[model samples]
Target: MAAGSRRVRAARRRQRRLAKGTHDLTEVQWTALLSAWAGCAYCGAEDPSLQRDCVLPISRGGRYTLDNVVPACRSCNASKCNFEVTGWLRRKQLDEQDFLLRYAEIRATLVTDLDDLDDPRN
Candidate 1:
């Protein structure tokens, strides 16, 4: 298949998977937003229009679990569209290690399985 076609197919699969996982996270997502206690995850804008975002984008093979999601302002979430989390953080001039540390904390909060505690992919 052509590269573009392959990408499109992959995106569709990711979308389907993400949709399945995010169908009922309204309350949990809102709680996450409130817990942010500041602003956008990427830009740190206080009181920006926030939305639930995937740190590891589904297009990049990320799950739609709470641990893989975060609270981001609309602007930051839109800007990070489908990009790998680390690369998007770098583009925004955010510290990668800091972001990873924060992500680890987020994951820890929702982690029930011990194996989920140490995902190197995040």
Candidate 2:
């Protein structure tokens, strides 16, 4: 397809996602999430993006809902697999002290992480 056609198609997808109650993650959002986390939620380092990690996974059976997804670096996502948040967290041997520090730990973290992208920093 033509470049203009692709752009239009992409725009329609964005509009659809917006109407469906989710904001699509651009590469920038993924980058911001990783940078803000400063590496792994499990282990702090530059993490692979092979798979996305969810703050809340779906096989606890969640909606594609905004309150649930997180941009997990690959290994963390793999560690998480398909279990409930706490279950996967435990499997990775993350203690409550550290596990409790994940984005889900504070509702405000969610707001801050996402909102920062659109905010103008001086």
Candidate 3:
């Protein structure tokens, strides 16, 4: 594909994601998420430059909310583009169950923290 076409496709994908839902993952939340994970969610690479990747993928109706996003290294993000998480992990010989379990635990903790922040008592 031509460079122009690729840009157009990316733009269209962005529009589609926006239409589907809000990208409400805040910077503070992102920081907490990164700290919780301590590395790439998929490969556990302790790289400083991690990208926010959608668990379900934008093309497949995923949004950038905290529940659907994780920190991924560039290589894993590129390799897993638009592919379902479990299947992609299996193909790469990674532990899908581990990722899922860890993700659930981290998400729960972060959500609880967020809720506490919203509470008047906090």
Best of the candidates, lDDT: 3
Quality of model 2 by C-alpha lDDT: 0.60
| Model 2 C-alpha lDDT per residue in residues 38-104, reported as the tens digit of each score | 6666555465553456565443444343455555666667767667777666667777466565665
Per-residue alpha-carbon lDDT of candidate 3 for residues 1-122, written as tens digits (9 for 90 to 100)? 69999999999978977787878999989999999999999999998999999999988888899999999999999999999999999999999999999999999999999888879987
TM-score, one value per model: 0.64, 0.54, 0.91
* RMSD (Å) of each candidate, 1 decimal: 8.0, 8.7, 1.6
Q: Which of the two candidates, 1 or 2, achieves a greater lDDT against the reference?
A: 1
Q: Can you tell me which runs of candidate 2 are displaced by over 4 Å?
A: 1-23, 48-50, 63-67, 71-73, 104-110, 113-122
Ranking by TM-score: 3, 1, 2
**Better by TM-score, candidate 2 or 1:** 1
Give the least accurate 10-residue stretch of model 2, judged by summed lDDT: 57-66
Clashes of 1: 0
